[model samples]
Target: MKKYSALLILGILFLILAACGSNDNSESSGGSGDSAPASNGNASSEKENQEEPAITNAIIRVAMKSEVDSLDPYQASATDTGIMMDNVFDGLFDTDENGELIPNLASDYQISEDNLTYTFTLIENATFHNGEDFTAEDVVYSYSRLAGLETGEPLSDKWAVVENVEATGDYEVKVTLKSVDSGFLARTIIAILPEGYEEQETHPIGAGPFKFVDYRPGQSLLLERNDDYYMEDKVPQAAEIEFVLMPDTQTAVLALQAGDIDIIPGVNAQQLMQLDDSVTTLSGPSNMPVIFGLNHAVEPLNDINVRKAINLAIDKDEIINTVMQGSATKIDSNFSPAMAFFYEDSVEGYYETDVEAAKELLAEAGYPDGFDLKMTVPSHATMYTDSAQIIADQLGKANINVTLDPVEWSTWLEQVYTDFNHESTIIGLTGKIDPYDVLIRFVDGYSRNFINYNNAEYNEMIEKAILETDDNERATHYKRAQEILAEDAASVFIMDPDSNTVMRDGVTGLKHYPIGKLNLEDLSITK
Candidate 1:
């Protein structure tokens, strides 16, 4: 798209050059009016016969649930922020239109005989947004910081296995892992930065298809095209992408109708029906599962019987058909079936709905009259609030008095997620390409395990799954880990709804990955 913008500017310059050359030719004719009259007549006739060229409008406006919590890739918490960063930063590896693993910064690589070390040959000629040459040292810095070498605490537990990282050559990076992982390729897509850039969290810079322009909290984020991107062929097609915060679905649908926005991602089926004929829709299964998360450390929920009763009371199939309009996949565990390679249907139909049985379980747990429960939910999207209402109604049927508490996204993030101060909450656990990334948040001792779930056997299974180098062996361990989560009734597992992407008349090119992320490079818009 940026290429087309450059070509259009050049075409206008060419027209100016032609007019100047005509004047020069006429001046060289020694003030003769003969050639001037003929030239003017031809120009007029040409203008009358030929139509003007149409300039393409290469810009797209997308909707965001809220402002990006952080600009730094390693520190970002909001899903929308991660999507924005994917366009502003280039990773060592990236996914294709079909969501397959492909090289981005690193051209190729080799693994050691014991499968503990990987040496990557970086691609030369790639430069950062600050005009610095990208080298292996930058990769080392990013990986080292990720593993708590720079900071006392690791930002995420997923990268805790990285034992060592060093620059073997200017463009060669070597990384040694504490354990063997067959799914480590997906982890290679982390954002790469300069060796010592300090303002990344405030004013970020990267060698991506897009560059950060401006951001305003609760309003919008603006990004401009990177014309000098390393891979010219893969430059973003859109000249600019503006993420407009649209916390309300109805308001966003109105914006799309008024031609103020070009796209609204993750729209439900009901929202799609409100649009007219001047729109296109792309639908596919999303890896994120809408879960009713229970606090295992809280009262009543700490008991296994009470947790099982809650799980048995809520009907997942009804939520899929009614709340999701039959557009979601019924999930029994944390792992989504969209990632078929590592997913197994081991716990399917395990908890059939029985309200009487749920009440009996409550009675067995010494809560015959049922206890009062407060469900904290984020009110950014009706997708969550609506489901919470239905689930709350379902729980009430089992004689469990429920109180609905809807809070803003930020408050929910701070209190319910970070503080873990609530009994239960409704949230979507976004998926990643790797299986471990999906389940790591629930594992014991994990910093992000806010659910407070602790099981020795489950932790041991996760350890075995990550260390096993063989694919089949790892699958066995992962499947058992998921089964353990189900047997313990860790949480009320919901459905993985289809990602419905709504675009205006001229917008196109939306890709679906195994992870929950959006890439704006392939999207194009026409005037």
Candidate 2:
């Protein structure tokens, strides 16, 4: 059966290639430039008219999988919500298209010689969506509110390194750190809330390109373009943006194909393959890692041999090929190829599928009969569930009994991190544009290390790497940490699939940013 499937896939690839050759005219539907129109006829003219519009009145309908948990920027965990909030709110610093840190709310920032303190000079003309002039006090207020002393949610662990955040002047905010942390700048990617946001959770205000208009819980979120935006000079072409929540991928894809939604930010691999050529597909490296997290503190997994066996049992290539439909690249390490540094080629991937070896290891660990295991997964995460199924099936081939318990994302997160048990589960780790961004959250034992898998040796090494100012030494320490993680089988690393976004051909100026963000500022639609 596998042989027949392989042959069918080869034949399909050949047919696709042959079709590509004959469809040259269809391939060149639009001009080859960032500003080029996706469709012909009056598109250029319509865009030109909107360029200097008598009234900037255009709506962009976007389909997303889930609604946001909280409007408070510091409290958001879902990427779907993060992307929306990120565009609607400005941070102290923002990453450009190339993933390089650039000034946003902060015009200029200076780090002290000791690197423990950073001072940011806020832009003078910036204002919140509510028309309040943005001041250094707003920055101080934003950070202080997330510090758990006020919000009591304990979401400010990312900024816990900062000892103090004070307004030195009308436009200058000074932040003092407990120690020199490498991820300080990237961590600033967290959206900054307007003053008194804790009291105004229902009506959050931000200094971003778009302002919050209305939000119907579990249905949709509406945002109107900020006409009086600080960066109005470089206005986002759309007049208003609507984020409509759809529960599943099939519905999201159907909405996009039916022209009900102009954009689907994150499209699943299977859905991307099924999309028509008329739809513009953007592919980029996702700064996320998919892994089967093991609870080493619990039984069965406490044995390193059992963990190693499970890692070797599942075939990552098969998962990427069958489950992901070749949309993903099999990954050996935690870092994505998008991250320029620390993605060492020498790091070997553990993708070898060997049922015999897995069984041998299980037997060596006194489980020759193959023990029963339960895997917890979120139904919303299609890819994670698919990967889990593949792993479960593969384990069954080795005489291992596996059961899948799928739950909602909220319940899954709560169980996986806080109330973790011996049950193995599949979850994805994202938000690692920089290596430090990953280390601070995963390895440093500070934030989101939800499984509570901590080692003093690992923590010491991570701390040393963060404090080390030398780039080379930091890289070395990070590499050591990654190697230790792989050797210890902390988690079964899976492939990092290519991130996908599907938009109609009529949509223009949709640029792919490296950090998995859709910059709709320059986007425009023309019939």
- Candidate 1 regions off by >4 Å? 1-57
The clash count of every prediction, one per candidate, is: 1, 0
lDDT of 1 at 387: 82
- State the weakest 10-residue window (summed lDDT) of model 1: 24-33
Tens-digit lDDT string for candidate 1 (315-415): 98888777777777788788767666577697877788899999999999999999999999777767677888999899999988889999877777678
Q: Candidate 1 — which pairs collide?
A: 1-237
* 300-323: candidate 2 lDDT, tens digit per residue: 887888888888888888877876
Off-target runs (Cα >4 Å) in candidate 2 are 1-55, 148-154, 444-447
